[model samples]
Target: MKKAVTILFVLVFMCGGFMQAQVVKSISLNSGMVWSTQKFDYKDINYDLPNEYLTGFHIGFAVEFLQHEYFSILTEIGYTQKGFKLEVDITTPDFPEGGLGTMEIKYSYKYAYLSPMFKVRKEFRGFIPYVFIGPRLDYLLEYPTDEFSEESAKYFNDFIFGMTYGLGLEYMFGSFGVGLIFQNQYDFTLAYHHELEEGYDSGVDIKNNAFILDLGVKFYFGKE
Candidate 1:
């Protein structure tokens, strides 16, 4: 985590050093689709583990704090519906029946991210090359599925915090612009729980992380 922050700071310093050209203050809107590479683990009362992934769309805004032909710092926010399904093999201590079933867990994640990104735009062309790294905060809004019980719902709250980083490309034509961004986030908090009285133990040596690959378009409000 500390390393990521340090890298972002370094990028900001570099952008500031080359900020003698014209700068613009504007905000842009972004909307695109996301594909989840891995399935989110969902646990049931019997401690069955199901694997799943999500495919959905996202819409967000990017507010430029400092923008020049070479670099920019932007704050972005978006709402996404990421859903995945987990399949657990039922041959364990609780279920000796040896059956196979699947459960779908859906999450509505609202995200707010602040990034100090650097871009290298052409002097006469509209092509822009950019890279971004920053911190991201996610709030899980809805987690409802028929496969999960009421007690399990409490374990899957709608709040998450993580770090985000990515690289992208953008093209501007006057005031109208389009961008493609591919970002991924690492979730530090494992938002998983069991029905045990002591609650779900944290040290299970399992994987608790989330990420997304985004391809979107952005409209810069000012002259591109």
Candidate 2:
């Protein structure tokens, strides 16, 4: 955790230094809802784990460094909420004939993220259409809590890495711009840390996936 925080600080410092040396085209504030899901891998477990999409939100600030009329590099830092819900039916030895009950669990998480994206835009008379692809680093700020089973509380990795790609349409009005953005992220690492039992491996393989829709406004610093 401390290491991740340190890295984030370093990135901010580096971005600030780079901005001072180059021309910063624009700065923006973004906030909107995030719809996220997860894919789980169970080794020896017999029952199926069904999860639904979880809704959350994110707020962030971004800096765009323009290299050409159509290309720019964008860096953003944000706080985001993401997670999923799990529903499963359990049958144990205590219930020889049938099952105990159905379990419905909600898992929630919060993270601080940094994303550096490459953006390509086409300018028109009234609006600009853009597409972006980036890699994001997420530092976990909260852990998962089980509503029913205390044993089910799993430890998540402190640092997560993901890829994000999106598209947006921005309406430019003088120095201000408003737009709608769509983004999707895919996590490459396991979502939880489960202690190994005799028959199971060290942990299960679970990855986080998210789709976000945001309405954002940008303030231009200088001439476009």
Candidate 3:
């Protein structure tokens, strides 16, 4: 955990080296759809549950540092909603036509994320195509705790380490630009430790993964 946190801070500072490096090129605001889910690694083979992707949203702003015409660094801060929905069907007599009722357990989490990425792009006429990849750090803002006891809920990991990568296309109209970006975040750290009251550690690991599609609007500050 110490190593992970250190690495995240280092990457963040590296990407935010605007003073020592190049000039600021642009600042952009982005927001759109987020599809997220959790993958579980169970220590005991007999225990498992079903999970499905939850459709959510994310909003953020980014600062781009331009070192050259074809390369730059992007530092982003964002808020995103992610989780999963578990549904089960049971036979019931409440319905006259059909005796089936669906019960759902929805787990929702909110996070604030920081991403420092390297971008490679090329401009074709007025169109720009780009690709970016970086390491990301996410802080858990809120999580569903109604399902767990207070002591157990405390096991939730507040910090998450992940990787961010994406491809995007933009149309530049003078100093203003509009773009479509498709990105994915895959976490290397566990979302929760989930060690129940029983002293024996089950080591049930849960990790988060998300797919994002954002419409980015940018305003160029100056040409580098």
Model 1 lowest lDDT segment of ten: 201-210
RMSD of 2: 3.9
Identify the leading candidate in terms of lDDT. 3
The segments of candidate 1 whose C-alpha lies over 4 angstroms from its true place after superposition are 1-24, 37-50, 87-124, 194-211, 221-224
- In the predicted model 2, the residue pairs found to clash are none
lDDT of 2 by residue, 119-186 (tens): 99999996999999999888888766534245544456777988888999999988899999898877
TM-score of 2: 0.81
Candidate 3 per-residue lDDT over residues 75-169, each given as its tens digit: 88888998888997755567555447677878899988889899999999989999999999899888887876786777788899999999999
Q: Residues 1-224, candidate 1, lDDT per residue (tens digit)? A: 34434644664564444443334355566666765423234333334344455666676656565556566666666666555545444466777776656344454333333433433344437777777776666665445455557756666644566666777777777776676777766666654544434565422212234455555555554464
lDDT of 2: 0.80
- Candidate 3: pairs in clash: none
The local distance difference test score of each candidate is 0.55, 0.80, 0.84
Give the lDDT of residue 50 in candidate 2. 68
Task: Give the Cα RMSD of candidate 3.
Answer: 5.0
lDDT score, candidate 1, position 85? 46
